[model samples]
Target: MSDQTTNQQQSAAAMNEPLLSVRDLRVAFGTKKEPNEVIHGINFDVFPGETVAIVGESGSGKSTTMHAVINLLPGTGRVTDGSVQWNGRELVGIGRRDMETIRGREIGLVPQDPMSNLNPVWSVGFQVEEAIRANGLAKTKKEAKARAIEVLEQAGLQDAERRMRQYPHQFSGGMKQRALIGIGLSASPQLLIADEPTSALDVTVQRVVLDHLAKLTSELGTAVVFITHDLGLAAERAEKLIVMYKGNIVESGPSKEILQRPQHPYTKRLVAAAPSLASRRIGAEATMPAAPTSTFDVAALAEAEGHGSKPGEPVIEVENLRKVYKLRKGNFGSEDFVAVDGATFTIRKGETLALVGESGSGKSTIAKMVLQLEEPSGGSVRIAGKETAGMSSSELFELRSKLQPVFQDPYGSLDPLRNIGNTIMEPLNIHNVGDRESRKQRVLELLDQVSLPRELATRYPNELSGGQRQRVAVARGLALKPEILVLDEAVSALDVLVQAQILDLLAELQRDLGLTYLFITHDLAVVRLIADRVCVMQQGKIVEQATTEEVFENPQQEYTKNLLAAIPGASIELGIVEAGDHVPHTPVAGSGSAPFAGGGQAGAQA
Candidate 1:
C-alpha cells in the first residue's frame, strides 16, 4: 500500500468521537491580481478530553487553521473550502451571532501574544467579566466579579481580586498571559485552542502554566487544540501530535511514537533542531556535527578581528542586588513584593553566562538592577571593577558605553515611528559618539555586521519581519561598541531556522568582539547552545551553578532535574512500546471524527 494511503487510514483511526472535526479545510487571500492560497486541503480532529498539538513552523497554517475553526479569520482571508464541525454542528454555515455564541462559551481561544490579545484601556477584570456577562452566565455585577476572581485563581494568578481592577499595562508579560488564559477559559468552554501558549516563557514558568492547563483540562474533560512550533513542548504536553508542513499533515501519531520514530522528514528536522535533543552530549560519533548555537555571538568575532584584547578586570559584578516593589492596594490588601532578593552574579570578559529559571524567578529583576533601570533597595553593582550602585546620573550615562541591553520583544524595543537606520543610530547619538556622517557610517557598518541589508534603513518596524526586527535590535546593541551585552530572551520569539541563523551570527560577533554576555532565557535548548556556564535560579536565588556541560549532563538540584525532566522526548529512548491497558490506543471505527481504516488500531507504534 502507498504511504499516503496508509497515513490517511491512520488519521481516520485516531478520531473516534472527536469534539471538533475539520475536513478538507482551505483558506486563501488577495485578489485575482495577486491571489495567494494559504491553506490547501487539510483535515484533523480534536477528541473529547484529549490535548492534540498542531506542530509546525511559522507560516505553516497552524494559526490559520485555528482562526478558521473559530470563524475568526481576518477580513483579508476567506475559507475557500472544507467544513469545520463542532459537536456534530456545521460551523461554516453558522451566522455571525450564532458563531459568537459558540466562540467563547463552547470553544475558547488564547492568542499567540497576550499584549495584542488584551484591551489596554479596560481593567482586566472588566474585560474578563464581559465574557460572563455577554454569555448570560452572570446577571449581576457581583456575580461577574466573583466569577472573574474564581477564573483568575484557576489560572494561577495571585491577587486575583485586585488584579481585575488593573489595566493590562500594569501586568507583566507572564502575568498578562495568565490573566488572558483566565478570560479564555472562564466560560467553561468544552474545547480550548491555545496558540504558542508559552513561547517565550522560562522553563519553570512554562511548567507551571502547562501544569495548570493539564489540570484544568483533566478536571473539566475539556478538549484542547494546542498549537506550537516547539517539538519538545509537543512531546511532553500533547497526548496526540499532528505534524504540519506547508499546510499538510505529513505525520500524525501518539506523542511518544512520533518523537521516537518520526516517519516524516519535517518531523526529523524538528527533532534535530531542538536544543534539548542536542543536549545529549555523550557517545557522539567522531564525525557528528557540533550542536547549534543561541543568539548572535558578537563578542567572539570582535576578538578574532583584533579589536583590542580583553580588559584586565571583570566587566560587571553584582554584590547582593535587591529590588523590592510595593504593590498598591486595590480591592484587596496592599503588600510589598520582592522581585530580586539579594541576587548576585558576575560576567567576565569574553564569556557567556546564562540565567536559567521559570517566570517570576527574578531574572528580569536582576537584569534591571544591573542595567540600573530599577533602583536596588540594597546591594552594589560594580561594572569594570568600578562601583555602579552610587554612580551619579552623569557617571551612569558614561557607563552606557560599557553596558548595553537587548530586550525580549524587538517590536516593543524599537520605535515604530523610526526606521531601522535611525533606530541603530540612536545609541550613537545618545552617547554623542560621533557627528551625523560618522553615525550614519556606523549604522551601515553595524547593519552589515548583523547581516542585515543596508536597504532596510528606510523601513519602519511594521515593515520588517520578526527576524529582521531582531537583527536591527542586535545592530542597535552593537552601535555603542559596548564591552558587555545583556541579552534578555533575545532569540526566544524566532523560529528554529531563524534562531539558528541568529545564534550563528551572535557566536561570530562574540568571537570577533571579545565582549562578555549575560544571557537570560528560560529555554534549556538555547542554554545548551551558547552558554559556557549555567545558573539555575528559583525564587530569586541561584539554586545551582555549573559549567554548561556539567549542568546539562549532570544536574544536581531537584528543581534543575525537574526542569530537565519536564523537557519533552527526554525520556524516550528510540523504541516503541506495545499497546496495553495502561498504554491505551483508540480502536478504529467507521464514521468517527477521525478517518477509520477498517479493523485497524488508531495509534502508530514506533
Candidate 2:
C-alpha cells in the first residue's frame, strides 16, 4: 500500500507539471558580422508521459532545434533568442556545471549520428558503464558492467555480453546505434530525446526499439521527443507532431490530424510521397500493365517494351561466392568467421535485383566481391560476362567503367573538400573519359538529369542535405554510363519522400539507359517497389529467391515472412496504441531493471 502511494505521488507530480517548455527559440551560426539564423521561434511543450515527434527533411533545422535545447550546437552556433525551461528552470545560458548535472539526470539525449558520438577507442560496454556511473545509477564498476549488459540486451542486441566486449570499429552501423541507445537510457532521465536513434536499425529492430519506448512511456512516464524524417513512423509512435521546414515550425497538432489533414503544403507533400502510407507500389505502370496495349500507341508501346532481349543476359553473376575472416578466439583454436557463404545470385541486364537482409547478413560482402573490391575466399564472380577473379590490373581498370557503385553513406563516399560539380567529375577524371570542358558540361547535364538545381555546382557536399548528396552520388555513378550499378544500401538512410524520389529517378534511368542494378538493402518495401526479383538472406546465405510478387504475396520461408511483418506502421494501420497492447519486458539476468531505460523497477506496471 505504501509503495503504491509513492508511485501515485511520483506519477501525479510528473503529470502535474510540464517536463520541458520551449517558446520562441531562435538559434544562430556564423561570425558576428555575418550572422545566419536557424530554428526561428519554435514553440512546443512536452508534458510527462507523452511522446512528441519533430519531422522534417535533412537540413530542415529539426536537429538544430533539439541541439539548441541541450546547448550542444556545433561550431559558431549560439542561441540568439527565446527560452528553454525544464521544470520552470531556465536551461539556456545556465552554467555548464549545473547543466551537466541536469543533462543526464533530467534529460537524456541520443544523438543523430552514432559514429560521431561513440568513442572509437572505448569498448561499447565501457561507454555504457561510464554513462551509468556519471548519472550515479550504479555504485561500483562491477555493478555498472552488469547493468551495461542488461541495457544492451534491452536495446535488442542478441549477444549483449559478447558484443559489449567489442569496440565501435568491430560493430556494424545498426549495432553501434543500438549501443548508443543503451547508453542513452542508462540514466533513465525524466525525458528522453532521440534524434533518428533507430535510423540505422532494420525494420524489426526499429519496431522493437519503438515498442520498448512505448512500454517505458506507459510504465515509467518517460517523456520522449523523437526527431526523425520518417513521417509515417512519427504518426504511428508520437502523440503530438511538429513539422519543420527550412528553419521554421510549419505545423503542430495531434499526429493523426496532421497526417490525415495536414495544414501545411510541405506536410501534404510528405504524406503524398510517403511510400509506406500508399497501398500499392509505384512503377507498376512502367514495369508491367494489367491489360495489353494497342499497336497504334507508339509512346505506350515504347513504355510497354520490357527488357526483351536483355532479360536473360546476366550483367552480374556470383557462383558460390564466399568470404571468410580469421578471428582470434581468446587463448587458442582460432576460428574462421564466414561472412558470406555460397551467396549465389544474378542480376540481369536492365533489372534491379535486391539482396534483402538485416545487418551483417553478407549482402554487402556479396556486393564487394561482385565489384572486385573484395577478394572472395572460395567463389568466382563474373561481371558483364567476364570473370573478375583472374582479371589483370588494366582489365579490372577497364571493367570499372562498365560497373560502378554508389555506397550507402553519401558524405563518406564523396569528398567533402571538393565542390558538388568536381565530386561528380572526379570519377570521369579517374577514368580519363573526357576533356575538362566536356566533363564540366557533362556535370551540368547530370545535375539536370538528377533534378538537382544547377546552382548546386559551386556548393560543397557538407552544405547539401542527405537527399541532395545522394542525388550527386547517383550522378557520379552514371558518369561512365555503366551497364551495371551496385547500390549498397544507398537509399535506406534517406526519408520516405527522398527515397521515393530516388526510386523514381532510378526507374526513369533504367528505362532510358537500360541500366542493371545490384541493389542491396534491408527494406522489404523498397524491394517490392524497385526490384524485379528478391533474394532473402539470413546469416550468410540466401534463404529464398523469387520474383517480387512471389516474395511479397506468398513468402515461402518463415524468416522472409517475419521480415515483411517487421516493417513499421504495417502492424498498426490506425495510428493508435491501445492499453495493454505492449507487454512489459526486461533482461533475464537483470530482471529487476528495464533494459534500455536505466533500470526498470521490478514488477512495474505494464
Candidate 3:
C-alpha cells in the first residue's frame, strides 16, 4: 500500500471513534459522608478534529464536568459515578501518576484567568519551555527554548524572542493569555480544553487569538472542547453546542440549530440576553413580549421610564483633558508619554455616554481624571458648572461623595477582610453620611436595590460568586447615592445572564434615582445596548462621537467600523427576528434608549 493511502485509511478509521467521551458523569464536592453534588449525570462526546462547546452561567457545573474528566477537580471535588473515557480508556479513579502523564501530553487545558494560572515570578518563556520539557517534546535545553519561542509566535505574541525574558506582570492581559495558550499547546496535544479563554479580552484581540487557535488546532487536527458563557461565540465557533443549566444539560444539538431554535427555556433566555446577537439600547420597548427569564420583569425593564436630562445642562464637562506620564528611560532621561491627549466631552445630568475603545486607548485615564483620582496635565474638569481645577482639599473630598467608581475586578476592588455589609457601609462611614444604625439600614437597602439577598450581608467577598461580588460592588457604589456612577468595565467580566441582570438593574436605578453613568468599555455590543451616545477612542484621541444608532448604522471612522466588525458571532444567522428591528424609538439625548443597527455577523469569516 502507498503511504498516502495508509494515511487516508487511518484518518477514516479515527473518525469512527470519539476522542473523549463522558457517560452519566456525576461530580461532587466536600466530604464523602456529606457530599454536595454539583455535576449531576451529564453525557457528551468529542470526536477527533471536531469542535464542541459547553456553555452555562457560573455555578452551572460546566467547568466542574471538564475538571472531573481530567481528574483535576479543585479542593474535594471528585467524580462519584459514571465514566470518563479518553481514547476508550477509563479515566475515573485513575492513579495520579497515570493521569499526570495523560494531562498535558494527551489532553491540554487552557484555563481562564491568566494571572492566577501563570507564575508571576517566572519569565513567560521559562514557563512555556518548562511545559515543553515536562512533556518531553524537546530533548535539549536549547531545543526547548526554541520550541517555546515558536509556540509563543504561533499563539500570536509579537516579538516573541524579546518577550521570552519578560515576566507575567510586564505583559498585557492579551499577551498573558497568549502565553497561556502557547504553554497549553506546547506539546501539541490531541484534545484541547479551553475554559473561557477569551473572556477578559477585548473584541479585536479576542478575534485575533481565537483565529490563531483555530488555525493551530486545524493544522494539528486537534479536537477542541471550548467552554464559555457566550452563546454567540459558542454558536459561531463550535459545530456542536451543549447548554448546561444547574448541573444538567438542558439542550444539545448542532450549533446553528441550538442558536436558531433553542428548545429549553434557559437556552431561549440565553439567546435573548446575549448582547452580541443584535444591537438595541437598554430600556427600549420590546417589539414582542419576552418570557420571564428571571426575577426581574423583562417588559417593565425595557419600558422603564427614563430620567429625562435637562436641556443645555451638563453635569460633567471635561475640557481639553490631557494626562501625561513620565516614563524613566535608562536611568537619567525620562520620556513624556501622553496617556490622554486633549480629550473633551460632556455628560448631561441624566445620560449614559460610553467611552469605547481597546486596551491602552486612554478611556480609563479619562475616567480617572473625571473622578479626580488623577490630576490632569492641562485641562479642566467641571462638575455641575464648577471647575475642579485648583479645588481645595476639603472640596475634593466632597466631590468624591458625588462621583463614585465601580471598577472591573470586583474581588480585587473589594476588601476581602470585610463582610458584605461592612464593605457597603464603608463609604458611608468614611464620608460620615449617617449614624451607625442608619448606615446599617442603608446597607440593607442598597443590597435590596441591587437584588442580592439580605442574608449574604454576613458573608465575605470570597464566599460570593463573581456576579454576586459585582452586585456588592454596585451596592457600594450606590451607598453614597452618588449623582454620577463611573462604571469602568464593570459588567465585562460577567456571564450573559448576570450581565443582563446587571444592565437591567442599572436601567431601573437610573429610572428611579435618576443616576448618570460614565460607562467605559471595549465591548461595542454592550456599548450598543447600554450607551445612548458613544465616544470612540483610539490612541488617546476620540475617533468618533455620535448616537448609538448613528455609529452602528453608519460608522464614519475606520476605527469605529473595525470595532463593530470585531464583535463575535456578528455574522451568525440566528433565524429569529430581533425586537430592535420592529420597534423604532427616537434617541433621547441622555435617556439611554436608542436603536442599534447591526447583526451579530462581525468577524464570522475569521
Candidate 4:
C-alpha cells in the first residue's frame, strides 16, 4: 500500500542518521583564574528509538553534562572540547539563530519541578501554545491552540478545553506534570530529555508517567535521554545505562547487565541499598542463635544487647483529638482557619502507625502536638499512660527519653556545625546518660546499629548523602531508645531506591527492636510497604482508619478515594488492590518526533 511505503520511507530516513552523537565531550566552569572541569572527556552515541539513562548521585556531573548538551549551561560554563552531531549535521558550533530554530522543535526538555515550569501569569494552554508556535508547527494562532489542546489531552489531562484556561496554581502536582509533558511534546521533538521527571511525585503518578513515556518512545521510535539518581528506576526503564560519578562515566552498559550485576563498586552499593522485601527475604539472617532462655521476648534480648524490641503497654494514646488555628486578617482580625478538626489517632507500643495525607492535611500538626513541639488547643496526649495536657515543661522533660522525633529534612533538623557523633550524643548528654567517653562510644555503637560505618562519626552532616544523614537522624532518635518514634516525611526527600532502603531499615529495626512508629507521609507506596495500620486524613481530620490491607483495598471515604483516583495508573491492577477493583482500558500512545539538528546542542552520549 502507498501508506506502508510512506511509513517505510520515514523509518529509513530516521534510521539512516544518528539523532544525537557526542564524542570526547568535556565541560568546565569558573573564571580562567580558577576553572573547574566538571565533565571529563566522555563519548557516547544516541541513535533513534532508544532511552539512554545517565544516573548518579548528587555532584555526579550528570546534570552538568545534560545542561551542556541542551546548551542551557550557566555563565562561565562551556564545552571545552567535544564534537556534537545531530541528524548528520554538526551542532556544537551552530549560530544562535539556528539554535533557536532547533530548541523547541528538535529538543524537548522536561525539567524537575513542574510547578516552576509554567508562567504564573499565563494559563496552561498559553504555555503549550507558545512552545508550539516556537517550534513553527502551526501556521496560525488558532492552529496553535488546537495543537496545544490535542497534546494536553494526549498527556492525560482530562477536559483539556476547560483546563487550558486555568492558571498553573490551580492544578495539582501530577496535573502540573502532565501540563509540562504536554508542552514538551507539543514541539514533536525527535529527542526528549527528562531530568528527574518523577521526583517528588507519588508512586502512582510516577508509574503513569513512566508508562506513557515508554509507550510514546516505543511507538514513535523517539530517542530519549533520561536523567535520574534512582537506580531502581534506571533498571526498570532504561535500555542503556550510563553510570556517572564526580564528572566521569564510571560504567556504561545495558541496563539489565549493569543493574543485575554492576561492575563498579558504587553501582553495586547503589543497587544493594534499595529498600526491597525481596532483598530482605533473601538476606534475613538465620535467627540470631537463640539467646539464653529469658523472661522477655527475643525483642527484649536484642534490646538488652543494644538491639532489643519488646512490645510493652501502649506508649502513646490519643482519642478524638482536635486542634484549630484561626486565621486573622481584617483590621479587627475576624478570620477563622480550621486547620485540624477532631483528628483522632493512637500509636501502640512496638508498632508503626502511618498517618498519611497530602499537604495541609494536619499530619505534621498531629506530630507536633504529640512531640510537644506545638501546643494543642484541644487534645489529650497520653505518654506512658498519663495525659500530657497539664504537664509542665519539667514534667515533659522528665519523659523526653520515652518519646523522640526524626524530622523530614535531616540537615534542617540537625545542627550543621556538630559532627554526627556529637549530634547523636546530644540527647545522651542532655539526659546526663554518661561521661564524654561513654557517650562517644555510645554514638559509635548507635551508628553501627543504623548500618553506618563507625568512621563516619567524625564527619559533618554536609558530607553525608540524604539517606546517610537520615540514618544518622534515626540513630539520634534511638540514642535513648524511645518507646515511640515519630517520623514526619523523614525519608520522602530520598530517591525511590534510597527511600526503599531506609524503609527496609526501619522495618527491620521495628521487627528486631519492636520500635513503635507514628509514620507520617503522603507517599502511598511507602505506606503500603511499611504500615500495619493506616489512617487517611483530609482537611485536618481522620476520614478513614483500617489495616493497611483494608485501607489500600477498600478505601471507604470519598476523599481517600479521590486521592487514590488522582494516582496515575490506578486503573491497572498492580496487586495493590483487590481483584474486584481492577478496570481494564486500552492505553493511549504518542508518536516521537526528533529534535532539530542545528540547535547547537551537544549530541547525547549513548
As for lDDT, the candidate ahead, 1 or 3, is 3
Which lDDT value does model 1 have at 107? Answer: 90
Native-to-model Cα distance after best TM-score fit, residue 504 in candidate 4, in Å: 4.9
Error of 2 at 22 (Å): 1.1
| Candidate 4, run of 10 with poorest lDDT | 597-606
| Ranking of models by TM-score | 2, 3, 1, 4
- Judging by TM-score against the true structure, name the best candidate: 2
Better of 1 and 2 by TM-score: 2
In model 2, residue pairs whose N, Cα or C atoms come closer than 3 Å (at least 3 residues apart or on different chains), thus clashing, are 594-600
RMSD of 2: 12.0
Which of the two candidates, 2 or 3, achieves a greater lDDT against the reference?
A: 3
Report backbone clashes per prediction.
28, 1, 6, 17
On the 0 to 100 scale, the lDDT of residue 224 in model 1 is 84
Report per-prediction Cα RMSD to one decimal: 12.3, 12.0, 9.5, 12.3
Which portions of model 4 miss their true places by more than 4 Å?
1-52, 56-199, 204-312, 323-339, 416-421, 449-464, 495-508, 511-513, 522-525, 549-606
What C-alpha lDDT values do all the predictions have?
0.73, 0.77, 0.77, 0.69
* Candidate 2's TM-score: 0.85
* Tens-digit per-residue lDDT, 1-606, candidate 2: 699999999878878788899999999888878889977888889999899999876677887898888888876889999999998999999999998998887888988667657888888888999999999999988999999998888888877886676677667677888888888888777889998887777777888788988888888889999988777578789999988887888889899888877666677666666665234445637563222121222232122222233655887788888899765456865667788898888787888899987776788778878888889999888876778878999888777776889876675677766677777877777876556666666677677666677767766765676667878898888777677789987776676666776788787777766889899887776777788899998888999999988888899999988888888766443322233343221111211211111121222211
Roughly what TM-score does model 3 have, to 2 decimal places?
Answer: 0.82
Tell me the lDDT of model 3 at 276.
Answer: 61
Residue 376, model 1: lDDT of 84
- Kindly report which residue stretches of model 1 are placed more than 4 angstroms away from their true locations once superposed: 1-17, 121-123, 158-170, 216-219, 277-312, 330-334, 389-398, 418-481, 550-558, 573-606
TM-score per prediction, in order, is: 0.78, 0.85, 0.82, 0.60
